[model samples]
Target: MGLYHNRPHVQDIRRMKARGEKISMLFVTTPDEAAAAAAAGIHMLSIEGRFFDATMREAAGDCFVQVGLPYGGWGSFNGRPLATAEDYLRAAFHYAGIGGDAYYCAASYDIQKTLADNHIPVVGHIGLIPSYISWTGWRAVGKAADEALALWRHTQKLEEIGVFAAELEVVPDRIAAFLAQNSSLVMLGMGAGPHADAQYLFTEDVCGYGLNHKPRHGKVYRNLGPELARLQEARIEAFRAFKADVDGGTYPAPEHVVPVKDEEYEAFLKAAQG
Candidate 1:
């Protein structure tokens, strides 16, 4: 839990984000995905609230796991959906029990501060925030001067409230660079360009199993789709073989069966006949 622990200090992540370093990684939704990401030397990860348990933590090894608390709209904030700051605090402590390195939320500033006050490293969302897409629509945000400027201000506000890092999603490189250079928060880029402190992508999108075509920014290192399909086929075949053996009475061979002694059988039959 000491030296080998994959989680870095909150201040450590802050320093790196402030420096505009390229923290390479993707989000994982399963133990197997986390294990694979850890094995690949990816330093950071985002795990959904559903996956926030001891099993996933053990599988993640030393990699950073940012537990995504379910707020609503997947990763968005609409209305008073999250309710109060206690919601964030409770979820933070709950997941932290299993060694979650950080917390990701799209809640309001008050809610974010509640988590931070309790010593939780909160990762806020910026640019193309899906939950608040009503204002910006479902497209790249911060492209225009005013939009970029607003995002810059948003970054500043997050830092002011004591957040450790922010996810800068789906903005252009130039705007992302400017925000990265100015803000104190760690900029986790999801197609928001190389200006971010870390590059973030979803494990599903990277594995070629995404519902939509792979985005231009996502670079697939492995194609597990076909591999997984092939494995499923093999499993089905193995089960079929066992079923066939059972139906044909070929499973319990002579060496596998025991027989009653001839003397015992003869005595039983003779007694019954008499």
Candidate 2:
């Protein structure tokens, strides 16, 4: 706890929402990216459990970090899928002990309640959950009037269950704006709109290293793909030069080898002859 004394706590994030301040959030996988986000003063970060550790937490610095627990069959324990509330609770505690400020759980409501009941700060998901996309398909949710009402009810249910925040993804702007204002839970908007408590995006999407199918909501700031390719080519060239030198006997040349004194060599030669 002392290690995280300087980092923003749950209450600090709540205060940001209360003050109507727009927060910036990113999903980062590497320590370098976390450190860079820390240096850039990003307000929040979402790190998956596999990538979250003491080193990653330290690199995140003062940013409020939400550790994502793998949902349903995606998480395993001793060859079994994590399908129960206790399974998720154990995972949540593990990350919490590692310095996670909050947890992102797209599990069932009952599981979410278990974490919330234990006083763990939890963030739930709404609108086009990728795991549950078989029902909604890969498109914006809550577009129709009935779907919008259902989304509102879903938000209310989350608040009732004690979830402190939700990842409001790919919903209409007006619906998201209304939900953010009316609901107690902080809205971590992906493509929800400008009015959500925090604007969230994946670091890969922001850095332009993502796959070809870019989400309409994502904005690429810098194209690092070409630069990364260039660096790879340079690495190959350097390795090729080393191989060529070794094959041509240019490596281990006189300057690269240790020299034996003439007197020492002569002494050894005379002793051998004797």
Candidate 3:
């Protein structure tokens, strides 16, 4: 509970948006990243439930963290997605209990409302949802007037459903700016635009260690790929050296082992003969 008290509350985040503050956010998957984000004064963090725990909360320091609940039909956990609204509710509660300031729900609106109904601060997603990637493909959404209008309408609906925030992904800059200014819901942008309340990016992309093709909106602050490669080579070299020592009988030199007293060895030999 003491660890939880140090973080920014949901109200504090809303107040920041109302004041037109530009928040910096990052998607982090490890405790080390969370600690670093907190140390670097990042305002928000989006962390999945699988990677979140008490240690992670402590590592996050004062950064507001949004814990992602597993959504249905996108992928499976234990061979199935969260199968019901109750599953989503239970998951959200679990993270909230662990000091999450908000919950990220990409599930149905009904499930989102269910969480909100229970007083959970929930963040919804609109415009190029990754769960629906099969239908939309991996591309920018809301490029045209019709699509932009639809995105705007959907964002309004999310606000009506009691969502505290919405993630705008890969939409046109004009559309994103319009939604941020016009809607009550705080808009967190990832490849959307500069006018969003918060700008979000994955830590991997920022560090240039993402294994796949980088997204168009990704801005790399450091090239960590080569350094990671160097570390891997060093790991292999160290393993080879250890193997050579074992094969050459140099690993367990006399100083590395213990010896029995002469009297004890003689007594053991006498007992064996008996």
Q: Point to the candidate with the largest lDDT.
A: 2
Instruction: Give each model a TM-score.
Output: 0.81, 0.87, 0.90
**In terms of TM-score, which candidate is strongest?**
3
Clash totals, every prediction:
2, 0, 0
Model 2 worst lDDT window (10 residues): 72-81
On residues 145-174, what C-alpha lDDT tens digit does candidate 3 reach at each position? 998999989898898889999888998898
Q: How accurate is candidate 2 locally (lDDT)?
A: 0.91
Global lDDT scores for all candidate models: 0.81, 0.91, 0.89
Instruction: Write the residue-wise lDDT of candidate 1 on 39-128 in tens digits.
Output: 888878898777678888888887888888777545323233445687567667878877888888888888888888888889999998
* lDDT, residue 172, candidate 1: 87
Candidate 3 deviation (Cα RMSD): 2.5
Q: Model 1, 9: alpha-carbon shift in Å?
A: 1.5
| Candidate 2 residue lDDT tens string, 1-274 | 5553777888889999999998999999999999999999999999988799999998999888999888766665445667889988888888888899999988889999999999999999989898788899999999999999999999999999999999999999999999999998999999998998999999989998886689989999998878878998999999999999999989978998899999999999999999
